[model samples]
Target: MSKHQKIVIIGGGTAGIMTAASLSKQKLKIDILLIEPSENHYYQPAWTLVGAGTYDFEKTVRPMENVIPDGVNWLKDSVVGFEPENNCIVTKFSGKVDYDFLVVAPGLVYDFSLVPGLGEAIDKGVVCSNYTDPIHTWKVIQEFKGGTALFTQPTTPIKCGGAPQKIMYLAENHFRNKRISDKSKIVFATPGGVIFGVKPIAETLMKVNERKDINLRFGHQLVKIDAKNQIAWYALAPNMTEVNPKELEISTNEGLVGIHYDMLHTAPPSVAPKFIQDSPLANQEKWLDVNLHTLQHTRYQNIFGLGDAAGIPTAKTGAAIRKQVPVVVNNISEMITSNTIGDKVYNGYSSCPLVTDYGKMVLAEFDYQNNFTPDPKLKQMLIFDSSKEHWRLWMLKKYGLPYLYWNKMLKGIDV
Candidate 1:
């Protein structure tokens, strides 16, 4: 068994499943093992609508048996540890399997406990994050029928930068349509100074917030939550810093502050997985050490990674998986055959279709660099395109994208 040609993928989600399909479709007669802990695979992008009441929760999840490529062995367990040095991994099930190559794309885990009181608040119903399991987001939204419905963005990099605000916008829209708009006060508290990373889209979001009358708080970090009292505490950003040769002072910094809330939507900080973080393949920030261009492990050419697990400095989105899959596939193919590989850089490309209202969206796309410039001119770009409202985007998200994801992206078929 150990003598066969094999490629072991560490996850069965977007990257893992797609990579397997890509390889198998090429008629590569090799042993492939997919290690995933859960039987249910989630299309996480649609969770925003589920929180908003636009989409049903059941629609976002699919059985793993349906998504894993045929001819690949699916191990329904997690990689408890990785022995990358020996070209193998130890899974909770299926024991230790050696491989000719490894593709790590285990996604990410949300550490709610990192923030004091956050876990308690989430459990108690005062605070809920759409970025996590999302089972309780609806409850949190309903509980906030009035008074201080707060949404927050943390200091760490999140999966979808727009997700926190998207949930907020959806909730606001729901309130408006449900005749409860006057009761709830929507407040967006973000650690970032801007509403969005992309500037043009940020301008539009600012206008939307103004029109919706949602309060925007910038550079505020959520440090704690009081579930019993429905109060949240945060450290506000400093106004300015003064530095001298001998010392530096943050004079305008304010005291840690507390605010009352009827409901809260939180986005927790994220980091690389523990296994990758502990391995020598991690970079300075402890993310998977991969070449920015090839998506191949910097030190180990036979190793590659994508999705949130990869240390590439890009907006972590499923759309990112679409781009990275090609790079990893091509690079790994070249490495196996000992050929001069062509360089294919990801350009940090990721997209967050902002659902500003029930039927309006500003598609934001950009590279790893902060330069979030969209295609110079799309066929349609304006606020007045009412026919193509947020609902169309919602349809794309709910109905269209999933098919494209399962049949096209995961199967490695270019559509």
Candidate 2:
């Protein structure tokens, strides 16, 4: 009977922590147990800034016990499997844990083996990734003299779609300030054709790319990394432009193009946790299958999911989680109180702060329909036209968001 839990939340990451805190703040007279294995809660959005050397990595993490809300109970154990039918979850250190309701928010993890040498090459030498080690990325960025600097991301879905190019833009600016602009060539090779999905944001970034003299290689996926030779190989991705992709400007060998680089910054392939992918809760893409708006499991009424692990058609950033948490919390609160969920629906809102240079950023906010939606409060703050780059947005990225995450969001205040 002690193993029977009232409300069990899997994962203590942003999603899990925020949900538990919000619920605890609601003063709901119920037991809530959060299951997580990690000892630290990371503020991952700041990693981009850390890679740019504009922010410190130490400030981005807090002890797990420090951030957990006062009332919510935390169980330091990893979930090995799930039995949604029986409303139960299996743990690694513990046995079967049954719960009246469950919240599955275990976030995404990396799988660098997708590329041949990426797993072994990352953070070791010239190959550096902010996702893995922002400190090493900064070190590599500073140590580079000048040549071809390659930036790329995997074809798989990542947390921030704009991160691969953010560091590139920062590094480009750094090179110019260091008097190496004439000798440096920055290249952004991505599987997607457009610089960004939103029309206004894409247009602005394309212009930024042009102004910085950076090459935008569309529909090129990182297939292999010959780190010893400092050669990055890419394949013509499925979305490759048909007319004339190569343009005969870069080197092409056999069917692949090998771009020799002085420094390479790339994100490893990311996917849902293995236990989740193998569980019944997963969709075809192996992510947690949940209603886009309600954040409730498509099949299991007593379960819900959000954050990077949810199979939502939106950017998997903290901003998206900001919108998702309210829906999940409200729906669950209604279910617990009235035995019926409310009409609180999430519009798939997500925001990406695209850092173009060291001190400049563009806040790209949109819905699931790919429409550019700006926050009205920005107008009150005398901030408008987020499609264009601004330092104020950079301020928000560097300081404002982090403040909210620690003071308000983690405590379930929601601003």
Candidate 3:
């Protein structure tokens, strides 16, 4: 190892910022540089609440400089490509920025182009998505007169998989409050067969769906949208080829399932940023090719990837990154000192606060292999099982988590 080493992190979002904050806390005599173009940082997990009109959208953003740790060199530039073989990265304006170690945390990008009409349809008329604009989503919800409200997600991995239904649940509650539930129907379409990956959470979500009278259109993969006609079209998901032949949702003539909706909430297809797909670091799926447990680049020993762009099989939520940040930081420290990984390994632990109603939520905490691992704090606080809906979990989603994120997590305090 050299007498002085520099760590360069790509992206100013949660993963990069958290990694930088964590590294800075280590007080290592290492030069740290963060390459990011955005001047504003967003606490995106709160965007779900924003769309539901429970959270202030203005509060989710902060100046990039505010969240960045002190002493870390901030290179306000975008990454265009990488020269990993040479331990340098190509930036849009700065050209090549060399580093002794690199952390790829640029996160993923929404590819609305993947769906034929989504690019033109999103954030317009009744087609609104929190991923695009939470304010627009709130407006759409307010203007909805109540008919068929369709919510759907693509088969591709997306940040916070529970977001689609979270908004749906909120909207249903709103409709019921307005006495429109009798005249309105909530339809949730998803490619996955189960409501959630973990068995216990899945069961609970199933019961919530039933209780809310939501029509679950499983095995449906949204393919296109006709905004003019207000019809969302879906094809059978690749993994769901064996769907029941008697499924009435199928349009026999077109071989597609068409749902006429008054309102549409879409969780657009998310993919690794184009630069990552073009770079050598991406896997066949165009995601960061990192070890699932170690989070180190499969081919580059000095590189680590986390956050939404990582190809970890777990749900990409803030809680997942919360668990992953320490592993990356500790492993990097270990490598710098002993030239090897330490005992720290991320077990794919991720938690999603599933808001089932206006004031109730279910906390879905699980690890790799879809094993349910509820938070011990729930038991400590006498909150009992997290698989079932509780008001305290809702409070966490609305208040506690955000407080922890800004004051503790981003400050490098392990909460």
For every model shown, what is its TM-score relative to the native structure?
A: 0.89, 0.96, 0.96
**For model 1, the run of ten residues with the poorest summed lDDT:** 241-250
lDDT tens digits, residue span 78-131, model 3: 899999999999999988999999999998898887788988999999999998
Q: What's the CA error at residue 346 for candidate 2, in Å? A: 0.8
- Runs of candidate 3 with Cα error greater than 4 angstroms are 238-253
Per-residue CA lDDT of model 2 for 244-313, tens digit only, reads 1222236678899888888999988999999999999999999999998898999999999999999989
Clashing residue pairs for model 2 = none
Model 1 residue runs over 4 Å out of place are 1-4, 133-135, 239-254, 372-394
What's model 2's lDDT at 126? 82
Order by TM-score, highest first: 3, 2, 1
- Tens digits of per-residue lDDT, candidate 1, 1-415, equal 3244688888888889888888887644468888888888888888877777667788788899988888989877777777778888877667888888889898877666667778666635667887774768877776666777878867777898889998888788778877888766787777777787777677778788877888777777877776777777778778422111111111222477676777888887788778778877789988888888788888887888899988887888998888888888777676665544546767788888778776556677777776664544333433233222345555556676777876798787754
